[model samples]
Target: MKFENLIMNVGYTDTGYSGIVQVVILRMTHMSMVNYSYLVVDHINNQAVIVDPAWDMRKVEQALENTETVLSGILLTHSHLDHIHLAKPLAEKYRCPIWMSNEEIAYSGYYAPRLEGINITPWSVGQIQIEPLFTPGHTPGSMCYLIGNSLFSGDTLFAEGCGLCFDVQGAYNMFESIEHLKKRITPDTLIFPGHSYGRAPGQKFSQVLKNNIYLQFKNKNDFTAYRLRKGQNKLNFFDFQ
Candidate 1:
């Protein structure tokens, strides 16, 4: 479904033990870059949870109103400025807790105080269970939300590329995280990334493995070398130095 200038990709999954869970992707753009937020709704209970609420609250608010689903909580993959700018307002408005990892809380010095929410570990909203996968790299405490067949891979892993690691250690961590994801997540799982920095906003894990160069590295040292070499040319070169 398309709304305004954003595209809403909808997916339905049956959890075998329970009823169906509906996943909706709300794609929006800010600063000439595309950002995506997700709504995972348990239709049977008329409850929903949001992932990475960015700019443009009206669009998000409209989505909630249209679905007639009460906002249960908000999930943050990481505490980046663009991702969490609207989190405070949304959380206050809905009277819901924002779920973020403790690591993210420590990493984001400025935003931490503003985030009056709950720490993300593993929790459930109705029948839709949320497991926080600690995929740190882009920032400490960076995580991916594992809900059924969907992986909300924040800035850690994009559709075609991965996040920019500012230091060698961060690069290594990012590499390890990707390796961990490969071992655990199914190839058929759908990946909803934080930024639309790829050919498409989201893709299946199988397609991502096939197309992403960073995910192909099996050796940590090799991936680290590659990341450092690549980072030298990017805007964060100063950080690497």
Candidate 2:
């Protein structure tokens, strides 16, 4: 089933942004789970970048073909195996660079020696400006990309939940990152999450603030207490593969 209000048109206007950028949400199922990959295209130039491409290269290729957009880069939210599995092959096929957090390269122990790596920093393609926010917690190098008014929040903040914090330190970091996001991102900012774990594929920051219980915590201690009370499973970094 598709999420409600899923955009299908090319010239759709984002909530806060005045300019129209082409964004296609490509949903791919892998290992009995749904993963959402995004194609952000600069329609004027026909240049595009794929974010968190995992499983089903055929669908990815088909999306690119249907949009008539050329892939210029591959952007990774983190180095999770599920997210990066197709990065190398897609970059190789398109002759484009793979952009990721350098910290993830060391933390996850998954290296791409062949594909050219562009350290995740604020950059742009055509008219689209991408600001990479270092929101660690889900992983040491977990990042959220703010493109225009849309936030490509890897595994950091989800619909009503947040990423799993494997340790106490990660939990603290996650809390701090969430606080920071609230300060930086506007109310109308659109959140495009990595997984299809939410009620919808995407959400407005205003709605998330109003609806997300995790974000309702007044302090870090409360957030940590809630996480601890919930008994979140401690994850092994390498086991994600």
Candidate 3:
């Protein structure tokens, strides 16, 4: 059950906290948007959870069949449409619950029969422990899920840059979220961001801190000014990149 030269792909083993749980992550880039849809394969029980299910179901289904795993859950990092388009259909098909931040549900009025608003910090499904870190900035309820050492940052932290901010406060909030991550996660922790943006996904956190220009500002004001500065015109932004 392997596909080469497809991912932005990463695989590793962790002698997990509750004994060894082999972690196999399959990432497929969205056809139009570059959204990194991650399928975390729990080899122990032949169960899997897809982070921000979106785009083609054919690829997802094929991955599941190849890995010989059943979709056990859907984990969302934010309420953005591009990231969440496949949640309900996949949930209905798999009969698995969906997890998203409670704040996002309140703000976006997003609802589903099986969509559960996650309030408590860390919780478990079956044998996996998922901690939803409230990393709001790109949106009010945007969150990043902490599973083992990998951070599934949806529109919050990118590999070489961060997610776009909506306003002044949001820019500041994003700064705080990034700073908070610096304190919380270790250097070796791998970051699997929602989009590739500047660098590829699945880079070590230390590399992000070192290269991400957005992460260098110590003062929130400076960060906000630079982030929200008037050069966001698509025409202008594309020139810089």
Winning model by lDDT: 3
**Candidate 2 minimal-lDDT segment of 10 residues:** 232-241
What's model 3's TM-score?
Answer: 0.88
State the C-alpha lDDT per candidate: 0.76, 0.77, 0.77
lDDT of 1 by residue, 1-241 (tens): 2223333443435355456666667776675545778888777789899989888888788888777788888888888776787788887888887878878777785353335434556678887788888888889789898888889998898886788787888998998899889987988788888765435554789999998899888788898888778425554311210
Candidate 2 stretches with Cα past 4 Å from truth are 4-18, 114-120, 230-241
User: Model 2, residue 123: what's the lDDT?
Assistant: 77
Q: What local lDDT score does residue 233 receive in model 1, on the 0 to 100 scale?
A: 54
* RMSD of each candidate relative to the true structure: 4.2, 4.0, 3.6
Q: Lowest summed-lDDT stretch of 10 residues in model 1?
A: 232-241
lDDT of 2 by residue, 131-226 (tens): 888898889888888887788897898876787777788888899989989998988788888775536655789999998888988888888878
Residue-level lDDT tens digits of model 3 in 1-241: 2222243323333434453333334444454354677877666688888899877787789888877989999999988887898899999999999989999999899998999889747876555667788888999899998777778898899877788898999998999998888888888888977766555567899888889899899999999999988857664322211
The TM-score of predicted model 2 comes to: 0.87
